[model samples]
Structures are given as C-alpha cells and as structure tokens.
Target: MNPDQFQKNSMYIETPEDGGKNFDDDGRAKRTGTWVTASAHIITAVIGSGVLSLAWAIAQMGWVAGPAVLFAFSFITYFTSTLLADCYRSPDPVHGKRNYTYSDVVRSVLGGRRFQLCGLAQYINLVGVTIGYTITASISMVAVKRSNCFHKHGHHDKCYTSNNPFMILFACIQIVLSQIPNFHKLSWLSIVAAIMSFAYSSIGLGLSIAKVAGGSGEHVRTTLTGVEVGVDVTGSEKVWRTFQAIGDIAFAYAFSNVLIEIQDTLKSGPPENKVMKRASLIGILTTTLFYVLCGLLGYAAFGNDAPGNFLTGFGFYEPFWLIDFANVCIAVHLVGAYQVFCQPIFGFVENWSKERWSNSQFVSGEHAVNLPLCGTYHVNFFRVVWRTTYVIITALIAMMFPFFNDFLGLIGSLSFWPLTVYFPIEMYIKQSKMQRFSFTWTWLKILSWACLIVSIISAAGSIQGLALDLKRYQPFKPQQ
Candidate 1:
C-alpha cells in the first residue's frame, strides 16, 4: 500500500535529474490537477453521445448479452488502462522519458516506426470523435427543435431536418470553442461536461423507467440491430448487428487515446500511478454504472423500435421540459467534449505546422511559444487558421456521414484496436517482461490477440453496414 513502493514494474514520477522531453522548463508534469479532476476528464472523454446508442446497441445483443458485453468492455478497458499507466514510468522513474501523449507512450515502448502508426491512430480517433460530436450536436439541435414544434403543432404534423445550417452553426461553435488553448484551461469546461453527462444520463434512466412502467413506447423484442426478434434468425444482417453492438461498447469505453494525457495532468510525483490507477478505477466504475443503467432501461422502455438515439424514441410532447433540458445538456457537453478529444489533434497539428513552417512568413506563431506554460495564453495566425480548418473539415465529415450509431461503431472498430488494445497489451507485455509462455503471459497474449480478431470482424461488419446506410440514407451535401 505504500506509495513509495514501486508499482507496475516501471511506472514512476519524474525528478529534475531525469531531463526527459515530456516535462516543462519548471520540471513539473502538471501544475494543477487531482484524481477528482482526472475522473471528470475520463468521464467527459468516455461517456459522450455514445450513451445515446446504448438502447439500440442492446437491441442487437439482446437483454442479457448486451449488458454483459458492456460490463466486459468496462473491465477490460479499465485493466488495459492500468497497464498503460504502468508504462508511464520506466524502471528508473526519474531517468525515464515522460510520456505525455498516447503516441509518446507507444514511441517510448515500441520505437519510432510503430510510433508513427500510433500517432496516426490517435489522431484518426480524435478526428473521428470530433466528427461524432458534431453529428451528435446537430442531431440534438434537430431533436429539440422538432420536439418544440411537435408540442406546438401536434405530433407528426411537423418535421425538421438536421439541416446544414444547424450543422454549420454547431461547427461554428466548435470553431470558436476548439481554440480554448489547452487542457489546463479546460477544467471548468470538463467539469461542466462531466456534470452534464451525469445530468442527462440520470434523466435518461429515469425517463426510460417511467416510460416502460407507464406502458409507453414500442415494447417488442428485437435482434441486436433493431430487427424484429423472431423474424430473422439466420443471416449476415444478424452477424453484422452483433459486431456493431460490440463496436458500440468499444466506442463507449474508448478513452485510451487520452489516457496518458489525463495522467500527465496530475501533479508530478512518485505516487502518480497510484493516483492515476485510482482515477481510472473511479472513472471506469462510474461510467460502467451509467452505461448499464441507461442501456438497460432504454431497451426495456422501447424494446424493438428503440431509436439508435434513445431519446429520439420518446415522442416530443410526452416529456417536453426534461427532454429539452437533457438535449441541451447533451449538446453543450459535446461542445466541450469535442474540444477535449481535439486537444491531441491540435497539439499534433500545431507542433507539425510550427516545425514544417518554422521559417515560413505566414507561420509567425509565437504567442504560445513565448508565453510561460500556465493558465491564460494567446494563439497566433497559424494556430487560428489550421485549427479552424481542422474543425470545419471534421464538421463537414459529420454532415456527410450523419448516421450516428453506425459512425460510432466504425470509428470504434477502426481505432480501438490499435490505440486501446494492441498498444497497451504489447507495451504491458514488454514492460512486465513476463515469460513468453507462462500462464499469465500466455493468457494476456491470447486476450490481446482476441482484441485484434474482434476488431477485424467488427470492422468488416461496420464498414459493410455503414456503406449500405450511406448509400441508402444518402446523408450527403448537408440537408438544408
């Protein structure tokens, strides 16, 4: 239990002598953070609009299987996150290179070649996440607007598209918000996001239960992907739905991209890992409960016909005030969540631009460079232009691929294996130096391989389904 007693083989706090690349000039990993703050960060990162898909996700896997998969993913992600934290410190903690980003961690453990892949995966995940957020925000706006209109003009009398204007408005908000400096400045935003997450999540649970108990909503059994339960027993449709369900679970728990970033935000010290592990435990446990309750209650409330977005299943008039509030909360939360996920991307792009164009006339980006690493900061033209473009592009992608649940599955299947599963498992095995065929080592290897297999299958299923949906739904050119 002693904090001084080294844990995770190599994970430790850095000292001045280490002279590692990841630290600041002041030799501090982070100026202000605690386990509570880290928990909030993880909550905001892991539990986003993905929660909206839970009922539909469960609809694919069935009552018992869905919740079980959710539980399993939570446990697995938590454990792998711990493995990742352990790699934060090398055997000689202070002398080891500080891993501030997940890419940094991969590079430190696997070398430069693999680091590029990690960097790609990490950035792709972040962009995918930002696009996901934009889609969710637009959808939330559309839902709220429709709900209001329905209340005013009777149900089914009016309908509204998740139009281009709304999507652009959401992106404009992101374009402004995404420029909010760095993680240090986002504590308040993250806290709000975390609170908003819980607010909507709990409200969702309550509404689901009330709806079910009050005998409202479509309550027929269905296959995992919302097909009528008894109608289709054997087909690729069923198989694809099951994989999509798995991918949804992965997406919900996928925070490995920012795991080290969150950890680095903690105060630098030997007990950093202990605190991080605790923070991880807190985050995992909290999200696990939310996912289970929300998903289960959502499915129970609207069995066969649950909307991919659970709240969309609710008729506009039934719970006007609460639904509007929840949607607003969800939208606002995503505005910050978009920035949180985009941080890594910003840093990556900014650093690249600074280096690639360090001599270019237009790239006079000195505001962030000259300032002392602290709270308030200013950004230059290069920073503004690149980041704005990035946000715009991602928002456009969201509009193009607006199928929320399927997009979540594709992103999850695409990035989770590389960022969360393969790297963490490989890094853990290397750091632990466990015997190759020993029981623990063998099982871990098997688990790692299983994740790869799962990702491959999930990718095939998701891509096929997404391709079909994109063709059929044609959410193209942004509906106006």
Candidate 2:
C-alpha cells in the first residue's frame, strides 16, 4: 500500500528458465541483449504513424471533447494495462511459456473455440487498420511529391513514387528490411524515427499557428451538419462544446500493444515487474504528452474544419519550407508503420519454425527453405508474396474507404474491445486463482459488455458506410 511496500511488491523476480524455450549455449541467458532497447523501439513503432490522425478524430468529436476524451482514454488505458499485467500472474496460468497474444487472452477467458470467432472479428479490424494505414502512407507519399514545397527543394525518386510499381517495390523493401532477424536490435532507429516525426510535426504545426494568429481576427459562422449537431450549436454554447471534444482526439492516440513486444525482455514475474512497470509508465506518459501537445497545437493551428490528413491540412496554409518538413516527417513516420505492422508477421513465422529446427538448422535470407516458418507452397514460396499481398489489399481498401475517421473509430471499437477491455478482466478472473475478484468485478464485466456492444454498433456503421459508398460508385443498382 505504501511506496516502499509497492516498490518491494513490484520488484518481483523471474528466472531465465521459467517461461520459455532455452535456445542458446548459456541455457537461460539471452544471446543478444536487444530487448531492453527494443522496448523503446516498440514504443516508437506503436505510437508513431497513427498519432497524426488524433486531432482529426478529436475535431470530429467536438473541440471541447478532445482533452476530456484524451484524458479519459489514457486513464482507462492505464488501468486496463495494470490489470492485464496482473492477469499474467494468475496461479492457473493458461498461456504459460508461450507468448500469449491478444487473442490468446480471449481464448483463455472464453475458451479456445470462442477464441476463433473472436479472432475473426479481431482480424477484420486489424485488416482495416493495416489497409487504412498502407493507403494513407501511399497517398501521403504521392502528396509529398506533388506538393510544390518538397518538389522545389530536391528530387529523390524514392521520395516521389505515385505509380503502382514503385509503391509496391518501395513498401516491400521497407517491410522486408524491417524484418531482419533481430530487428529489435536496431531499436534506437525507432527513437530516432520518433524524434524526427515529432520535430517535423512540431515545425509544421508552429507554422500553421503563426499563419492563423496573423490573419484570423474576423469571426464567421457555419451551419451544423449530421455529426456536427452533437456539439451544442447555440451561439453561446458552441465554443465550449467544441472545446470538450479534444479529449477524444487525445484518447484516439493511446495504443497498448507496444508493451507486449517485451515478452522476451522482462523476466516473467514479481521481481522484474518493477522495471517492466517503470518502462510502461514512462512510455505511456511520454506518449500522452506528445499526443496532447500535438493535438492541441494542431487544432489551434488548423481549426476544426481541417482535413483527414493533418500534414495536408498544414501544407495548404503553411510556408513552403514548413510543407517540405511535413513531407519528410510523414515519410519517416511510415517507416515506423513498417516496423510495427511487419514485425508480427515475421515473428509468427519465426516461432512457427523455431520449435522444430535448432537455431542453426533454420534457414534465412531471401531464398525459401523447408522450415516451419515457411508455409506450404501456397503461402510460403517467397516472403515477398505475403508482403505484396498485404500492400495490394490495403491499397484497394484505402482507395475505396476514404473516411479514415470512421475507419479508425471502427478499429478502436472492435480491436480495443477484446484487447484492452474484455480480455484483461476475463484473464484475471478466469485464469489466475490467486488473483482475487471482488463484487466490484461486476464493473469490469459491465465495461466488457459495453465494449462489445460498441464494437458491434461501430462494425454496423462501417458496413453502412461501405454500402453507401458502393451505391455512389454504382448509383443505378436496385435499392436493396
């Protein structure tokens, strides 16, 4: 309860042989001490790309809502994360030794068969995020090229790829290069990437703010539209109502999976808990500060009617130099995306194979070989096939579904439902007998149900939006 007691409790120890396969000359010792650094890398990877979208999400919610939602979201995320970490301590651990994923928590709670169904839902959402981001980055790439500011400055072919061939080639290269075995070893690359993204974003935002400050003395009014109606539109109430929505924008920035990357890093248990907890706290706090500053500054600079792409919105009003900086920032941010999205596929493959072959027996490189990491002929001929497939699929979806705000909301409702809400509570209650569940446990149950219901509603909304788009693309079709 006290600080000293908390510290002691947090410093729980985990043995080397405790939670996994021993695959080196030194039985429990790690061959490469990359995970500590990788922890920071994973933080950058998880938090980097999607953050630029937060202000837009908040603006949609209403200006007043931004900071409130951001704070509330962070609080919920922090609480949920602590609960999840505790769940791992359950006496009857279901996912012992194996690195349990988000779906694994669902399986342990709801049982394996149910996990498959939940996994399907989760996959749909993950696929949406994957596709949406890929398309966003691709379009961003083209936009960077067309923007007069970046164009006038210099001409790097890699920096300006609008055609399909170059898009696929460039994206694939980034994805593959990111997957090199101990890519986590290159963790500092992520911190550098984050710093670059932050710097670039700051410069563009500052420029936009200066522009707005100099020439926006005149006031104007606009009619409220469908969603805009949610904000109090009365002349006196509108300003405060809009201000409240900033929290949701901030909330949109809290993604939690970065901590999972350290399954190998932290020794599993009570002893190493302090270091792990400290790391998570630091990562979350740093991320929250970054989001709040960027979101507030962005909305202040661009105003509520800003477009889906923050950089694009800034570019429209920014000086040429600032626009060029924005382009470079966006490009660097995409590299972070490559690291986050691509790593899972690579890890999945490596784990699949590592069980059968000794570390030395496993083959590597561009060539395909007979290993568990390699799938049967259909899916495993070349790693390029999978990477290319994801890029193409993502591109098509992005072009078709350009309502990125709605897409991200759906992603949050679906993926975060099982991942951050339901699974943590369920795993703690169901798996760990040592973990006590009080009558207030009903609160978590209620939260889980709310998350599930919200996800279903959001999914329906996505379907409705897609249907409407289809009608627009083919207006002559019979009314269904």
- The top-ranked prediction according to TM-score is 1
- Ten-residue region with minimum lDDT total, candidate 1: 1-10
Model 2, TM vs. native: 0.68
lDDT of candidate 2 over 1-480, digit per residue (tens): 011232343334455554546542223454242435534744564465456666555554545656666766666666676666554323434234332344444554556666666556554545656655555565455555455634565435323334344346456656556435557677676666778766766665576567567756644222222125444334423333233233223225435544443533555433333455565566566677777776665666555564556666655333655676666666666666555555555455444444444343323333444558656322233344445566566655555555444455556655666666666667666754433455657777787786566456545554554555566643221111
Per-residue lDDT over 103-164 for candidate 1, one digit per residue giving the tens place of the 0 to 100 score: 66776677767777876777777778888888878777777888888888887674655456
Off by over 4 Å in 2: 1-27, 30-46, 89-111, 114-126, 149-192, 208-254, 267-270, 346-386, 432-438, 461-480
Off by over 4 Å in 1: 1-26, 29-41, 92-98, 179-186, 217-219, 222-234, 265-270, 365-379, 474-480
Judged by lDDT against the true structure, how good is candidate 2? Answer: 0.52
At residue 294, give the lDDT of candidate 2: 66
